[model samples]
Target: MNAIQFGEPVSGKTVSARVSPAGGLDILSRNEVARLRDASGSGLHQLLRRCALAVLTSGNLSDEPGTIFEQYPDFDIQVLQEDRGIKIELKNAPEQAFVDGRIIRGINELLVAVVRDIVYISTQLESGGFDLDETVGITHAVFEILRNSRILRPQVDPNLVVCWGGHSISRDEYEYTKRVGYQLGLRGMDICTGCGPGAMKGPMKGATIAHAKQRRKGNRYIGITEPGIIAAESPNPIVNNLVIMPDIEKRLEAFVRLGHGIIVFPGGVGTAEEILYMLGLLLLPQNQEIPFPLIFTGPQQSAAYFEQIDRFLRLCLGDEVSRHYRIIIDDPAAVAHAMVSGIDKVRNHRLDNKDAFFFNWALDIPLPFQQPFRPTHEAMASLALHRDRPRHELAADLRRAFSGIVAGNVKEDGVRAIAEHGPFVIDGEADVMRALDDLLKAFVAQHRMKLPGGTAYEPCYVVRT
Candidate 1:
């Protein structure tokens, strides 16, 4: 299998390769292969190409998808169906993904994951394989996607902790996340994250050393991402298992369904979006009794950040919402201890409810939470952020508001929309809008919206309080 072949350099370096699958996607039907090869107006090839390029150029710093696309404009990929099995063909690929001539083993595996997920989702999920209309059906679809990716382990206990935070964070905050991850690792807890740099990469980096110290074998450092955001935030090297959900909502659901607990580090609107999503679910009557541990922690410098977050939550969701999460400031060891204790409670709760250890099947995720929220200008403007609605409903809308800001800040389509539409307009009840405005102002002042070294961030939305 001499797959490596030198090709004309697109920018200093380019390589063409016909690589065999690592394990999961070794076989494909003729129709599937055809769909992957079709680069027409109606085919999976463009999506596959974008996702494949993202994986091939993993670890690149810039999150601007346009930057990546412009740099590798001629880069292309194809899924070849040979007599024996399947192989991927790359044209003008990133040189960093290769050593000497062969593709890096881990990159190849992740590339395979990109292919496997894209193909499965395009072919199966869009068809009748999984229902997308109802809440339970959508969740079942999420479970099936994870199962097909070979990530869910039936025998493993609830130990995977989903860490959510901004890819762009301060040096002190990044280090703090690592210390927390090290503590979690020492207690044999695995790490799952968004799989980019900064806070996403820090915990996994810390866990590696602790896992080595404890001789923890088969430690899962999983990274769950989506196609829209994958290019901006490439998969970090520490991510051993990568699964790309179809959208942000699904990606968020996958985190809640697959993990035992969640730990949120200091972040901007994206992290706030995640916090709201989880809290909104927990605020529901059906999910009130479910033992899901959520902690918001960072270094002492980040205490004010969490304070703003806390204040915003109380102002919007009321004082009762504060009970959903514990704010632990500057204490990594205490955070881990609390998580360990909390996870034990999670395990017991699951056992009492007769739920699967690998997936949180018993939790009732409402339909609004399950369905995808497209952050178009109209959609963003139409959000009901007033206090007249039910608390949970209002929380869901708040979650959507932040989610739209997240899109405007990072996602390619969102960036383009802002460029064309001149910022999304967000209007709501005066008090909620004021609190939201204050929180967003803090995020921008702290440089939480863009990566640390990137260009200055312009406001992507206007707040009408």
Candidate 2:
């Protein structure tokens, strides 16, 4: 219930100094620095500091953001304005972020992304420049965020595979993901992920070797994350391109838009939320014809986990829901082969439909799935999880339910809220609740709820069956 503890030992640590931006973020307006320095009640300074710390502490194996802050309570980052550009000053950052007193190149790039996203969001809100109330407006905001991050490639083919799974996966599952990544990479496909550890890192790590073997040049290992979950799931070191969306909604949207095919590794509620979100979108009549290749895969040991997920999906969304994705068990080569083939179909479909290869413009995402779902006590209780509504609509609510659990499990604010206000009461149809409870119980029982070496797992949500 208290602030979740985090970070490794800091004993025998000393201060370090870093120079100009590593990923080409060398300029920021005076206004941006002012906002970043404003640690007051309504300021962005605190958020900036927390996110910056997460980047500097990249490759952290911890899932508790509170622990990171607790370990470095005195850690402070300052945005210094210079005539030519901006310079970030760290008061007590992690020594691991630096080598020979110089900030690591990748970490510096991630740090700039934090500053870039924070400033951009602050500017949008202050100027009333972004219309986030409507579905289209929200999508536009997501697009602009991606564009500003320079992640939208203009001419690249649709080869980016978004690998979604838990950060606390078992070693076998993690190794399996790398093999799949290696296969995908050898065939010239790129990797995109939530940008954390476990499954997220495995694929990127594997691809590096495969790319080297193939003599592939200019490979992109993109890591997309959001502020709320960034600290808990720090960016892994393998991510060459990192972009931080403002929230989970935008992060999910970025994945669905940027990825040609999706490969789901064994995961917990967070992964379920992602699967539900994508399925909910595909279930819509408008998106039924879209050629989006989605596969649920893992090593032989993880077959049961995906089987449980498949059964849960069938029960909640009906047998027809299985049509949206394929399940590949234990075969890394086959999973990669399927993904490569699926991406080819996606390419042809996009070309025929005149959709952008960089972003899937043909796939239509409805308002419910695009808008941010705030996981407050009231909001969580008010979710329409019953089966009376359209199947896609029900899936949206189900996604929200899982999203709330993910927040409570890791997000700092969500964790604090659950601590103060008991567990979140997720009410729904009796049958649906039974299936939901069963799936979540499996997650807890299998030690998938948190990192393996951390504290014992506890349910943050309560299913009112």
Model number with the top lDDT: 1
Candidate 1 lDDT, 1-465, residue by residue in tens? 011111122242688888887878878888888888888987889889888888887767676667778888889998888888888889989888888889999899999999899889888855788889998889988999999999999977889999999887877888898999999999999999998877888899899999999998999999999988888888888888999999999999999999999999988888999999999999999988899999999999889999999999999999999999999999999999999999999999888878899999988898999889999999999999988899999999999999999888878889989999899999999999999999898888888887655567789999997
Q: For residues 187-272, write the lDDT of model 2, one tens digit per residue.
A: 89899999988888889989999999999998999999998988898888888888888788888998998899999998899999
TM-score for predicted model 1 compared with the true structure: 0.96
Range of the 10 consecutive residues with the lowest summed lDDT in candidate 2: 1-10
Q: What ranges in model 1 sit over 4 Å off? A: 1-12
lDDT for every model?
Answer: 0.88, 0.86
lDDT score, residue 226, model 2? 90
Report model 2's TM-score to 2 decimal places: 0.96
For candidate 2, give the lDDT of residue 235. Answer: 86
Report the backbone clash tally of model 1: 1
